[model samples]
Target: MNFKKIMQKSMGFYFNFLSFVNPKKLKKDGFELFCNPFARKVKPHQLEFLQKGISDVLDLEGYQIQTYKWGSGSKHILLVHGWASHSFRWKNYIEHLIKNDFTVYALDAPAHGLSSGKSIHVVLYAKVINAFLELHSEIKSIVSHSIGGFATTYFLDQYKEHTIEKVVIMGAPGEASDFFDFYKETLGLTTKSLNLIIDEFYSQLGKLPSYFSSAKFAESIMVPALIVHDKNDLATNYYYSIRLNKHWKNSELILTEGLGHDLKSKELVKQVTEFVLN
Candidate 1:
């Protein structure tokens, strides 16, 4: 973490914290979209071309799936966006991947983009990914950022590798527990209160679900993994990615400097695409 990313992550945290206290800032993160009658980021970008392609596929179960055909080849690459972001967040990556002649799947997770949930958790995202893999058994690669990166591993833990051949987890935390802890601090909830809330959340579903830790799952991965993490990713705290790489068996790490938690660097995207294709 040089001077720039430190500053950016600091600002993002401060702003996110400010919103947590003020409630108005929560809207900035798209929390109010539940109450609003209109669509947010993912809805507007559900172009005719994308919608028509997914309509021929399996049902969303809880959310909508969008697709775009890149080339005649059958090598499919699934692209997942991060927290508070939509499939459109991968606009740059999608275009590049498409130009490279690979089938692209840019999904909108539940409660995000064009999905139907009012809110979301890592489990739900993993479920959606597994279901999609069940329907399309040719997903050759996965590229996920931040929370979605965690979901990629969660999906693996849930269904035992249905489609994904290899993956690139960019800026994803090594553990969901850390993010949950961060959520508590951001929400001003104590550990006891957080546990109570999570317990209630679990009870609503009628069961306790097992979570995936990237650090643990990395040791069990049979496929290749390349983690691209910036040293300055404050949201995830660079140590998480380092720990994952340490545990992973067939994995490589690409350490960066400028990029923070966003993981939107073109160089990182290109490297990930290359790793997947190779």
Candidate 2:
């Protein structure tokens, strides 16, 4: 087996053993492991790309959020990246937005890029987005990928008062339970172990895993939205976008083939730009 498979097997064995011997410790450790991003290494090119934009750090709830801005257009736009990803992922969209004369903003989600934190969850990420939105109420357009999309929808759902005009969500998971299911399957967690982790999650967040559904959150978000997903996206099933689109009322759905989760194509950039501009 490869290194990843070997690690998964070892983790499964370790957690299973802990479940039988020390259920209390298993809950704490499993919850932490679930929240941990594994911290993707920042590439030199990515760092250089981020440095090109004006940079600032915001201290929010004891976490330092690294933000970047480009262009000086009267209209403002924001970009939110997904799990295990940083702002560099928005380089193509940023270039396109700037060329269209948009003042673009992007942030490194907590624990993902230069931000300070060891762990994160959808609720915490939503709060981070809320804090940034509070500062830049002029930002009316947003483009988000994966979990970033989920957090954005959640923010709009809870806050209910904002200046957001348009939104674009790409390859975002519809249900938070999907993440827990994936984690349980990947680590081969025993039922008891998974239950312990679920309990711990509730203890920390005061909500069940099922509470963070994007489709459910979409019902409350009344802004015009563009939902793009690939039929073959392995990271997040496109069906989630289909489900979210059905409930989003003012949203449009674009189902593409072979683009996978990133959805980084010139054509997609054009579609997103046109949607934001028009």
Candidate 3:
């Protein structure tokens, strides 16, 4: 077997064994592992690009969130990146927004980029977005990718009072259960271990994993939005966006054939800029 498969099997064996011996420890450690993201080192180009922006840090619930600002236009925009990704992922989008005279803002989500955290969840990310919005109330436009898109939608749903004008959600998952299933499969977790972890998740978040659905959140968001998804995206299925679009009354859905999940292209930047600007 391959190394990754072997490691996954080993981890499954360990967690299953722990479940029989000490279920409590398995719940705590398994849940934490599920939330923790692999650390990504900043590249030289990414660092250089990030250095051009005005930098600030916000202390929210003990996590230090690193934020960046660029441009000085009257219209403001925020860029929210995907899971395991940092603010640097928006380099092209930032340039496009700046060229369009938009005061662009971006943040490295907790546990990603320069932020100070070891683990993250969608609710925590929504709180982080809320904190940033509190500070920059003028920001009325948002462009988000993957989990960032889901968190943005959640923030909008929870905090109804805001100045948000337009939003772009790209390659975002519709259901939180999708992640839990992926985690279970990746680790080859036993049903008992998975159930224990789910219980821990509920104890911490006060909601079952299936309760956190972007489609459900979209139902409450009235802001005009553009939902972009790739038909062949292996990370997040395109059907999620379709389901979300049906619920988001004022949203538009765009399907691309082969852009994949990241959706990084000059054409997409142009389309998103147009959606936000006009």
Assess candidate 1 and give its lDDT: 0.68
Off by over 4 Å in 2: none
Give model 2's TM-score versus the native structure: 0.97
lDDT, candidates in the order shown: 0.68, 0.92, 0.92
Across 1-278, the per-residue lDDT of candidate 1 in tens digits comes to: 68866654564455455444743443334222221323366454445345533433335664655434444455788888778777676777777787787778777776666566666667777888888777768887889988888888767766775767789988897765565465555445444444544454455444433354778766667778998888888877778788988887778998899877876778877888789989
Q: Evaluate residue 65 in candidate 1 and report its C-alpha lDDT on the 0 to 100 scale.
A: 52
Candidate 3's C-alpha runs over 4 A off are: none
| TM accuracy, model 1 | 0.76
Best model number under TM-score:
3
Q: After superposition on all CA atoms, how large is the RMSD of candidate 3?
A: 0.8
In model 2, pairs of residues that clash are none
Query: What TM-score fits each model?
Result: 0.76, 0.97, 0.98
| Candidate 3: residue 251 Cα off by (Å) | 0.6
